[model samples]
Target: MRSSVDKAAVKMSRRWKLICVPTVIVTVIICFTSTYLLLVKGTNRWGSGRGLRVNQNTRRTGVETTRNFSRIGNREEKTRENITKVVDREQNKILMTNSAAVAVCCTDLMNLDKDKAVIIGRRRKNKGFLTIGIPNTPRSFGKSDLKRTLKSLIQNTPNDLGQSHVSIVVFASALDQSTRLSTRDIVAGFPEHVQSGLLQLIEAPRSFYPNLSALTGSDLYNRVKQNVDNAFLLAYAMDSADFYLQLSDNVRAPSNYLQSIRDFIKQQGGAYWVTLEFYPVGFTGKLFHGGGRDMQQLIHLFTEYAREQSVESLFGHFKDLNVQLRDAVRRPPLFAS
Candidate 1:
C-alpha cells in the first residue's frame, strides 16, 4: 500500500508541473507583449521624442547603450517651407495674369485713342459727360459681380445720353490681380463701347500704395481709405468730365439709375457736390462736378480728417463717416495754403 501511495503522489506531482509550466509561459509572454506595446504607443504619442536607438559605438566599450531619437521638429519645418513655396507660386501666377491683363487693356486703349478725334467731336455735342470710377480689390474680386454691374449700367443708360459721353474707369488695387484680369476680359466682351472711348481700364502697381493686407485698423477703415484713395487718384486724373460717379463692382442699379442721375444733375444746376443715398443709412458716392473744384475741396477735407486721426477712429456707423465729412466741409479751412 505504501508503494502504491508513493506512485500516485508522484503522478499527481507530474500533472501539476505540466499545468504550471504552461501558465508560467503564458505569463511571461503577456508581460513581454505589454512592455513592447507600451513602448511603441508612448513613442508615437510623444511625437518622436520618446523613441530609442541602439548605439553600435557601445560595442567598443563592451556595453550596450540606447538613446532617444527625434525628427518631428525637422518634419514640421519642412512642412512649413513647402506651404510657403506653394503660396509664393500662387501669388506669382496672379501677378502674371495681372501683367497680361494690363497689356491687353493697353492695346485696347491704343485702339480707342486712334479714333479720339471723332470721339471728341461727338462729345462736344453731348449735354453732359459722366465718368464712373470703380475700384477692384482682392477681397471684392467677383467676376460675375463686375460683369453684372457693368451690364446693368450699359443697359440702363438713358436713351438721351450718348454712350460717347460716358466713361467707365476701373482702378484695380495692387493685390487685385485676379480682379484685374477678370475685369479686362469682361470689358473686352463689349468691343463697340471700348473702341468708342467709353470704357477704360487701369491697373495700380503693387507699389502704388501701402500694403492693404498689412493695414492696422478695422475692415471698414481700410475699405474707406482704399476707396477714398482710388477715387482721389481717378479724380486727379480726370480732365474734362462734367460728373464723376463712383460705383462699386457689386452694386446693381435700377433701370432708371443713370437717367435719374442725369435728371438729378440737371436739377442741381451742374456745379454741386451731391451725396446720393442708396440705402437709408449709407450713401452712394455720386459726386457731381467730380474731378473739379468741388471734388478737390472734398478730397482736401477728407485728407484733413485722415491726418487728424491717422484714420484710426474712422470706424463706426456709415452715417458717422458721412457726418465727419460734412462737418469737415462745414468747418473753415484751418490753413488756406
Candidate 2:
C-alpha cells in the first residue's frame, strides 16, 4: 500500500505560478491571509488535545516497520520464485494480477490515479440523505482516533431516519496490510452499523491518484499529504448521498446533530447555497448540500488550492464565488474538534 512517499517529496517553488493560473487565487489568498495562521493554530488545539492531529510523526513508525518487513518478505519471495521460475511462470500470471489488485486493494494513497477513482465497497445499493466521509489514516497521533469519532457520530446520529437516511464512509486512504487489517477489525466492532447498511468501509485503487510531487507546494499545507487526502474523502463522498458532510477522524458532535442539520436544510427550502459551516474553526464540521454535480464543482475548486493552502483557508473564497448572497451565518456549532 506504500506509494513512494520519498519520491513524492519535492522542494517548494520559490515563486508562485503567475501566468499559468488564475489571479483570483493570489488575490483572495492575500486578502484572506490575515486569519490563516490563526485558523491553523486553533485547528491544532481543539478536541481534547487531539484536534486535527496533522503531524509529521503520523504513521511514521508503522510505515518504517512495514518497509522492513516488506524487504524481508520480498527477499524470501524472490528465492521461492527463483526455485520455480520457469516451471510455474505462466501459471502464476493470474495470481500475480490478483495479487497486485489486493496489494493496492482499493487505496491509491498517493493519488496516483488522476482520471477516474476506482471505489470498492459492499451493499452499495441503498443511497442516503447524508453521507459522512471520514478520511482516516493509520498510526495517527490521536489515541482515540476513528473509534472515538465513529462512536460519537453513530451514537448521536440515528441509525434510521427513514430507509438509510444517513451512512458513514470511513475512507482509510493510506494503510499497510497490517494497519488496514487493524482498521477493519476496529470497524468490525460496529457490526450493527455495518449490517444495517448505515456504515461502510471503502477503498480506492492505486490508479485514482495524481502526481503528488507535482501538486505539492509549501509544507504548511502538505503535512503528510493530508490536504490531498481530505479532498479525496470529499470527492469519494459525492456518490453516497444527497448531501455530504465532512468530519474529522477524531471529532464529536452534540446528540441529535444530524436531525438538527436535516431540519435546518429543510427550512432553507430551495435557496442557493455552497456550504453550511458547523464548526467555527476548520473543515471538520462543514455540511455541503449538494449531489454529484454540486460536489464535482466543489471538488474541482478545493483540489486546486489544496496543494498550497489548507482547506479551511479556501472556504471563504468558495462561498464568495459560488454563493455570493450567503452570509457567514452558521447553525449553533454542535461539532467539537
The lDDT of each candidate is: 0.47, 0.57
Q: Give one digit per residue, the lDDT tens place, for model 2 in 7-86.
A: 34422232344443567777778656534543654343324344442332222211111111212223223342352343
What residue runs in model 2 are displaced by over 4 Å at the alpha carbon? 1-123, 138-144, 211-224, 328-331
lDDT of 1 by residue, 1-337 (tens): 9999999999999999999999999999978766675575444332454445432222211111221223222322334345334334433432244465434433332233322322111222333477776665555343436777777777776544636567766555434456566767776776766666566566544443434456666654555566455434444334547777666676776776665665655653422123443322122344445443334434433332332332223222121212222321211211110
Q: Tell me each candidate's TM-score.
A: 0.47, 0.57
- C-alpha lDDT of candidate 2 relative to the true structure: 0.57
TM-score of 2: 0.57
Indicate the residue-level lDDT of 242 in model 2. Answer: 78
